[model samples]
Target: MSEFIDGVITEVPQQYSPAGELDHRVHADDHSNDWWRHAVVYEIYPRSFADSNGDGAGDLRGVRSRLAYLAHLGVDAIWFNPFFTSPLLDGGYDVIDYRDIDPVFGDMAEVEALIADCHSYGLKVIIDVVPNHSSWEHRWFKEALTTEPGSPAWARYHCVLGKGVNHELPPNNWRSVFGGNAWSPVKNADGTDSGYWYLHIFDSSQPDLNWDHPDVHKEFEDTLRFWFDRGVDGFRIDVSHGLVKAAGYPDYPQHADRAKRSAGGEIIDFEPLPHWDQDGVHEIYRAWRRVANEYEPMRAFVGEVWVDTAQRRAKYLQHDELHLAFNFGHVGAKWDALDLRERINEALLHDKAVGAPTTWVLENHDVPRVVTRFAGVELPKSSGDGDENESADDALRRLAVLTPEQRVVGTRRARAANIYMLSLPGSAYLYNGQELGLFEVVDLPPQFRQDPVWFRTEGKVVGRDGCRVPMPWRNEAPAYGFGPDGSTQSWLPQPSAWGALSVQEQQGRADSMLELIRTAVHARKSHEAFGETDFIWRDDIAEAIAPGRSDVLVSEHGGAGNRALVVLVIGTDPVDRPDSELLVASQPLTDAQIPGETCAWFSLS
Candidate 1:
């Protein structure tokens, strides 16, 4: 067993080896040019990941200290959420300076060291790039606030005159993704309200930049080079579809679906918003792609594009655009066999059309933990009528506290989901704490909540604080060993139950979620079946034995020497295991049957 000193692993246990007794890395030394193609990129919400200095917030040094743990976990890359200079209004998405590191995260030298350390461990680093908007405190926005309406400084953002006769109303009938109006009135230097209202599709503190401006293009291009020159592998472009708006600042349809964006960053009701998924946005990505190609072993770009359909989403993945775009279909799909199959096929088929690899994401910083979402736990309805009248605190109070039985079901399904996702042909993204089987911190005190969504909606929306809770590292240490010794608090409170789910608790256990993920990731990296292969739906599994059984899903990928079979049983009934050599199973199996809510892989060569 690995020994832990204040949640930091003091000794590297044998089981923690990236590869076991046998070296299974098929392409061990091949850090090929296109590493992101099938790479397992682990997403880290820096503030919640680790606290090296016991300052209560996670920082770059914290992440650097945990690099070994990640390497042991067997991910090819680490994708960080924004650590840029920000006001923290939108969880670091409201970037104040694209070129500098936020003090809350660390200094530039630390980031440079982190990048160097990651490369030393054969781990590539992907940082976030928030181009859609700038923080209200950003120098550009402050300048815009001080300048005249049509001045060059103001031209950087969408600051336009309001439509009311007295210039008192917002420019158009648009709603913020967080809540209320999308346009916030600019203030004069002496604090008088300026007639012009600036657009912020999400939070009022995040003013949208005018992408039409040539300076805006030049600025972002320069920022891309700023990081690319620093050995950064790639960037996860935030709100990739919202940079460009329709011409003339067209008014949003009055009766169109105005559903609030989900915690997962998906449009709950995905219609073409006047300011989202516009055709002009592709031009920006195409330009960005050229900048990325400027570096040797060309850097990659993965867009957080949330469009209505798979076809539209694929547009962002064209040849010279983004290398990959997040496929939210997996996160949004119901926990049913047919639903998952459809989502998987849709992503594969559409991404294949564009000759781009499909990216699979189960959970991220913005979404509810899959363990909570898949547990079949439902929050009670509010007494108030709909969201408009709902009290955010009351709704948070009413969030479903998972029952013990629900935890079991959710964990089993989540494990199976990871195995299933990893078996696919393209790249997969793992959120931190997911391997620990951490559930959403639904009961976070209303007073401690900091997400702008909750405050913007006046507590009518609980926001994503639940999923951003600090990671539990030790079962017995203070703050669950999330911070340095003697540290008593984390940025967000962690549940006591997490003591049983911490890394120290599951370090060497054979059946632990952490180990399962490690084993799966190692298998994915070593096995040739996951590399280059023809993906086929294995109807033969059902046709040969469980004929007419729709609950069982089977697929195969890889060529002659590296073929592998995947079997997922989503229904209650057990299915006959594949005749090939058993490689790995999400859960312990009984006899020769794969039980419900279980996924298994087998070597077919």
Candidate 2:
């Protein structure tokens, strides 16, 4: 499988290996050394990003309209959430059709335009691909329901018989990541009980597919070709660890957590289970890799893999498998400096062993915003595990727990943290509203809330709606310019305070969050030390910050031998730093010292 890109023959070497990877004949060097290896990809939740039409929801046309903004922000790539035909359940993860664009969004032609526009700006376009499961409304799922259990349609997904004498119970006791039974009773098209259960790891509307079927492999291979032909630069695979379940669909380990979660459920790390991170999943990637290799600049796959250890996380990025896997260890860490350093060290060591650069993520669409996360009292990992499943209303009824003082601290810390994050080697991802220093909108009206996690738990859990609120593009309008004009109302309500955080407001201010980000990102893209693999720790700074607050940390990049590309973070409190050429600072330096909540890049003398 190969194609020519700019006179260069780009194709995965056809070779054989038992591990489902390219053979020794095909070296990693043979693969397209794509721009993604050094890219700082910006993740856009399409519905919340800039809206072009007055329809109040973002579409491909809106994304195209905003290419100049992303280009100016200096990101090498833009990764969009799924825009495929979907029921909008699970935030569009329940894809109804892989090939068609949703009506709410534009058509395939609009997508082609968006890609062309992005390429014009020298930005690569990567769209979401939800491969682990498809919507119950999907054509295959509908046919699988009525075509009999052993039919071709049924074989495409994990459609199977239920248990008990009358087949009344679910197929197994497996739990859904969204809570309740993982197996949902199948209803015939004629509106009668089918007495069989189908597997859905998340929402019941999203039924898991049977990857063991050869047809499933061929179908996705064709899909890869479909998008590759369409000029899509890459795909962010929804659940890369998922695809092939362990044989027999066994129950989780006896000691696994019963409290269900969408993140691949409770990971029983010590033992392998029915699904999630199975070795067979790699074989699928190898085949997909061949398909991607056939393209011009070589399409990439970024996996949303949620594994426990860094060692296990590294396995997915093997030579022939996925190019990058999100390190959740850093994503879930608290605001404490010690924990962050430890996570960074572990991530670096693990990814380095597998010859992959470690990725850093400060905030994403799924979780609480970094400013909000930092504003609150830094909780231990177990601090707020399950808050008695507080309903959306109940949670909103509570006062704004994040105090004004806390917000100021949180915002500063977030901006400074990002500067430090970008300075690190490897790639980084910036979620939609982080540039505006937008905290989570934790108080959306009950009627406006839509995350499936809320309904799945019977409103007992307020899902990730807060962070997914419509972005504030301009300072004016009740909807904060998320939509086209002042008259259009955004799908999700924009907070009144957003007028202060809007991009329109931040444009001219030198000290605005947007400006800080623009400067840092520019430095990241153009710095010679950046994107280099050289990293060293400077522990001597601990003497200045003192033992009571050993929070200050400095990391030297690029200058491995004589000179150094220095990055010192004075997080806990302000501290004097050695005088040097200050390249960029998240905050104004005081007395030739790195101030608290500031990360400064330096050009060593």
Candidate 3:
């Protein structure tokens, strides 16, 4: 591993031997100061990971119980969705308490224990911080309601007097990401007009915080110190590019607003959006980076900054700002060789210029699962006005729904895609259940859906709840083994067909999705070429579409450019394999050739 004087090189701690856990990764003798540069982090939505007390919700203790499983899976860190105290609106994004864990998830003690357990398993812990907004129930917001307009508590949030007779109209025509108007009128406890409104870019229950307030800045610093002292390895900042809105919160030109913006022909790069990715946001991060650097091991921060272009995304990764900002280009690109190649190259080139590691991600909790997105349908846009104001809705709705045949194709492509993602330079994030080859559950009975987008949009949009379902543990009668032995209640419903996809069903089978992931992570962690932050496009191995050989996607990097090419190939063709030792393959090749729908790593040693 590359070393830097400023970086922390950690020795592998004596590990924990939990029930049914496998210790498979090779422990490195040395590591770089930037351990996160090439790390593979797994995202966990706590409420869906496991339910320890049969409370029908996944809790911190449940995560502790499964720590060994994650460790065995060979991930470097676990990035959890917010488990802070909340009112359950926006699925915990509407955080009421930043200092303590939500009672439903467990308390502060459980969080401390979970972190210790993860470290014991040689895994780091990164928790989510929803800094852009706060639950309306937060003490600050509640007090803001009681105080007069322009009061200190009111100034902490985006609270302002409405415009019109008796102050009835919203401050501006800004739109709510959840749906409808972004401003919600505040009423006094006696149910009378308070002559003011609060800006809630998301659900009305989540009022946006005023980063302009000096107190807000100090408050987050305090929050960061509290958790860092508690030993969290790092934090994944929610809406990292969104804490500061443009001055005045002006209206976005409605005429220019389009329902879908995607990685199609023209990117969503040059639009004059006023609410997100503002310059002031960087100042906040520059200060945050300073706070993160204070501790040993140099605490890390990954941004969920969904800007329109790679260059814009890179701006957040400037040395003193954020360590990593997600590049969504590859994740949102169509499942085409050219589209994928260009996105990856563009991200690598931009990040290289910025002297930052490029982050490659296939899917996350906020968007449609890649399997469904890459089914060659209209790329399902995550609900909101972010990507060109929404997501890509260019494809006809008829093709959006995956048919039985489409699912098979999608699944195979997804398998190959994951290997391709693991092969890329720099860091990567794997959402929970991604290894299980999970797709968005579109057919959830309308009644079972809980995403606020469904209600806020009056069912016009389904939002991302489908991707957040509690994962299947085993093939049991109720909840597919999500809860306790005899329980039927999980926060979300599990599909009956998921029985075959359960961890118990796929555990050790060579062709199983679980095995493919385990082997891929194991191989990725061990390979020298895969760990470095470099990618040299294989100019000779052109991507084609002629049937069998056309499906191949190859990119090689690491070591001398010409001396020994580290080739990563994914396709279905029976061919003369790369002239190298096969380090690992997502699935066994056919007839000694790189098979279709499989990805293989080769070292030309």
Model 1 lDDT-worst window of ten: 8-17
lDDT of 3 at 159: 79
Ranking by lDDT: 1, 3, 2
Kindly report which residue pairs in candidate 1 clash with one another.
Answer: 392-459, 392-460
In terms of lDDT, the best-performing candidate is 1
Error of 1 at 306 (Å): 0.5
lDDT of each: 0.82, 0.75, 0.75
Off by over 4 Å in 3: 1-31, 188-190, 257-272, 377-401, 543-551, 560-576
Off by over 4 Å in 1: 1-32, 254-271, 379-398
Per-residue C-alpha lDDT of model 1 across residues 93-190, encoded as one tens digit per residue: 99989999999999999999999999999999999999899998999878776677889998889988998776888889888888789998877778
Per-residue lDDT of 336 in model 3: 65
Distance from true location, Cα of 450 in model 1, Å: 0.8
Tens digit of lDDT per residue, candidate 2, span 1-605? 01101111111111112243211111134223657766789999988897777787877788787777878777889999989999897778998888899978889888888889999999888889888999989998887876766677888888778888878888777777776788887776687667778899888999999998887787788888888898899988888888888787777765665433457766434344577778899898888888888877778888888876787788888878888888788877766678888888877777777777667788787877888776654333332433454433234322234768988988988888788888777788899988889987877888988887777776566678888888887878677877776546788888788999988888647788887887777776665566634566665544544445666766666532323334445455677765666777878886566777677777654
What ranges in model 2 sit over 4 Å off? 1-33, 188-192, 254-269, 378-401, 541-549, 560-571
- Give the CA lDDT, 0 to 100, for residue 470 in model 2: 80
Estimated TM-score for each candidate: 0.91, 0.88, 0.87
Give per-candidate clash totals.
2, 1, 6
Give the per-residue lDDT digits (tens) of candidate 3, residues 543-600: 3322344444565544432222333343444445565666666657654466556666
